[model samples]
Target: MTTTTTLKEQVLMTLKRQQANALVLYLNYKKYHWLTYGPLFRELHLLFEEQGAAVFASIDELAERSLILDGQPVADPADYLGTATVTPSSGQLTVKAMIEEAIANHELIITEMHQDADVATEAGDIGTADLYTRLVQTHQKHRWFLKELLAKGDGLVS
Candidate 1:
């Protein structure tokens, strides 16, 4: 591939990468929500719903942004699963374990997103940069939520 690729190509590639990650995480969050138990079930269920909602929203924005950049988006779930760098399936595990898995996944996405932001910046793609930065913030929020689960599950006063 040429170094001086069109802005659309860079954006589409990055968004595809992100979309793959987001789709996996979104479904994983829903899985956790459905299977969660214990005293924290209500709180965690709501939190997962919110987190899943946000991930879905972010994907919508990212996919639309790719369209704005004049590229087709990867929308099918099978395509996402095939392309995702983050594996979503880990089989049955404890609720807390699921939360921890999600945290790890989100952090992984964050690292990739930072690199994606740098790529967008290098390409002078401000729109994609803004999207990736927002995504990072969203991942941080989800990480905090999952961390809170660990803290709460541990019987902490906080």
Candidate 2:
């Protein structure tokens, strides 16, 4: 394949993976929003809902970017679960565990976004590179928030 073709495929793959990750993350946030309890219930519930909205928006952006590159974005909910790099949480988890899970999921996406951005840059796809850069920044910010929450107090409640 030509370089342009290869780059397009790479970009599309990255976009799809990102879409999947965002979908899973959004769903996980919603889960936590509904299930979180105890001392931090109100705070964590609101935060999870807000984060869910943010991730849902990112999912739309990823799909649009894929279409802009003339690639079909995965649209089905099942597809998101199947393609996601971050696995969805199952069973019951404590509030602290939910926070830790979110942090880990963000880390997974951040690592993938960094790798995708590097590939896009090497392939001369500046737009895709920029997209990944922005995504990385967003995930990093989210990760920082989760980490800071974990850091507060004596680990019992933050």
What is the TM-score (0 to 1) of candidate 1?
A: 0.89
lDDT by residue (tens digit), candidate 2, 1-158: 24656877987888899999999899899999999888777888898888889899999899998998899999877788888889998889988889999999999999999988887888788988998898789888888888888896665543
Clashing pairs in 1: none
Clashing pairs in 2: none
Lowest summed lDDT across 10 adjacent residues in model 1 is found at: 149-158
Write down the RMSD of all candidates, one decimal each: 2.8, 2.5
Q: Number of clashes in every candidate structure?
A: 0, 0
Candidate 2 local accuracy as lDDT? 0.87
Worst 10 residues of 2 by lDDT: 149-158
Q: Give the poorly placed runs of model 1, Cα more than 4 Å off.
A: 1-8, 152-158
Q: Pick the candidate with the highest lDDT.
A: 2
lDDT of 1 at 60: 82
**What's the lDDT for all of these models?**
0.83, 0.87
